[model samples]
Target: MSTFGEINEPSSRTAWEDWDDIFVTDDFLNLRLEKDVDIPKEIDTFIILEGRYLYDCVRAHHNLELVNSNAEVNLCLFKTKELNNYVCMIRDYNLILSSEIVELLKKYITISKDVIAIVTKPIVEYQVSELVSKDYVIRSISSSKQSTSNLDIHFPNLEQPNIISGVSAGVLCWREIIDKPAVAIICYMEHPEEQQIQELYELLERFKIIPDIAKFHRDNLFNSNLYI
Candidate 1:
């Protein structure tokens, strides 16, 4: 079992390299499964939710089946009973660690025509007053043919010197290889808040992925022991 630290060891590839050497390991598979777990053969859309905050928000609202998991990540594969859409949620502590799971999933599932990925970045990284004033900023990345007009939020390009890693980057690279269309929604926030979570909930709702937001805030408040 090769650990992520060993797999990510210093490579000769430059910073700009994307998906050059993806290390795949079966060590992360859940031992409960007699054999490998495979994703659904045909998928309407493949959605990847990268952060723990986003994962918690969705899990709070919807019923997701635990397909397989390991110490680093949980693979929740479920279908929306109403929409009949096959969705796979890869929940990870760090987005970067998701790359390994993504590589593993690729073996079992065929890349869907539409891949929606949601990830978060820190506000300090951008330092834009516009972003600071709002709960969060959404930057859309898609193929030229795809329209983001429905989002109704805009921002300047990510600019140079910035690099995208993790499962989001891995998916984009795969999209290019498979000639499929993918949409990546990058949400920038200082921390997870009710408003930020609500915004993401609404976005996923629009995609017919998640159900209505439940009264999770109240539960969190009651469960918290923090004095501040």
Candidate 2:
């Protein structure tokens, strides 16, 4: 059988470079299976996986549960290489932790009584500020999106005082809630420091959901879309 992309791609003569021909057809659904594992009762003890590698980790480990992502979310993150596997992998996990980062933030806001939200819309910004005014920090950044490679800044110490504000404003806002350096760093970049990444993987080792991320390098990383 042909891979999903091979079957779907139009012939070179007829296809335009700008054409967005992707679709999440019916084949990619209901992939999860029932299983049991000892999940940490304390919310902070469990790890959150995001981006392309999330599917790989989920497919490889029965113990790691699906949290936020679904067919729609997977569709947003999909690239041509992995094709339908990305869509179907969502069904393999037993839990839906939370869908969007903002939802996760709201939970933290309730527990920590501390909030920091990133807003692109002025009207939403005003509403969020008003609702959380007593105990939250609201910072502004431009709504414009830019290519990831355009960013070249780095931070050696995340806990330092008076750091470069608004550098990666979205990431800076998330840093307010995520305590782990690994989580904040991954949130900041598509590709992050190898050592720090290894640190994160090692952290996962404690939970026995270790992903084969150690073998990742520049060439294969792009091809596999593992980092992104």
Candidate 3:
């Protein structure tokens, strides 16, 4: 388990920053069985979904077709706000993750149907220990100190170590707009192959973990003004 840097102020920007395990099916078994083998050499690549992409995906969960005309008012109210605030508010409920995200969304579906209850992972350390038990590593590179005045993109050198059989989606959290982004935990698969890779991503998508992946990207870059 690894730590994402220090947490900051307790604002409405409550980060589900604890780095809980991004839910995966039990099919994502442990890595101890093949810990001794050499990792495979495939081109390491990643799929990038922008913030809007995930926002749209979550919004898609709000199905208006089946609801009766009376419930339409609640749906209308739910549609008026920005996705980020809505998501932040939804996070405050402290709902259980025992089911799939889609299923959870269905259960706790309405924003207010008037006022939605706003609410506000893993240890590769304390954050994710219960979620992930597999072994993995964090790969990073620190560059020369750059000007803090411009909050531009800071790309990673991407000189990552070999991809293993099991690797969970990158988890990202921000205590505030000003802090640096960090990895939550890393997991490995016992054997890496095209099918397994596809399956891993499919499971993540099915469980709706893609938003956390996008959050990692969103938190890592700064605006031209150095704002998060």
**Highest TM-score: which candidate?**
1
TM-score, model 2 to reference: 0.30
Candidate structures ordered by TM-score, highest first: 1, 2, 3
**What are the per-residue Cα lDDT tens digits for candidate 3 across 78-123?**
2112121112111111123212222322212222111111000111
| TM-score versus the correct structure, for each prediction | 0.66, 0.30, 0.16
Better of 1 and 2 by lDDT: 1
- Tens-place lDDT per residue, model 1, 1-228, is 757666563667557655657778775533232236665656666677777667666666554444555444555655665553555565654554555666666743344646677777775665443435765666656543443335443435554455567777777677767666666777777766444456666667766666555633422543468666
| lDDT rank order | 1, 2, 3
Pairwise TM-score winner, candidates 1 and 2 = 1
Candidate 3 CA-lDDT value: 0.24
Report the backbone clash tally of model 1. Answer: 0
What are the lDDT figures for the candidates, one per model? 0.60, 0.31, 0.24
What TM-score would you give candidate 1 relative to the actual structure? 0.66
Predicted candidate 2 versus true structure: per-residue lDDT over 99-200, tens digit per residue: 333332233222321112211112222332224332222222222222233222232332223232221233334444454221122223222312133443
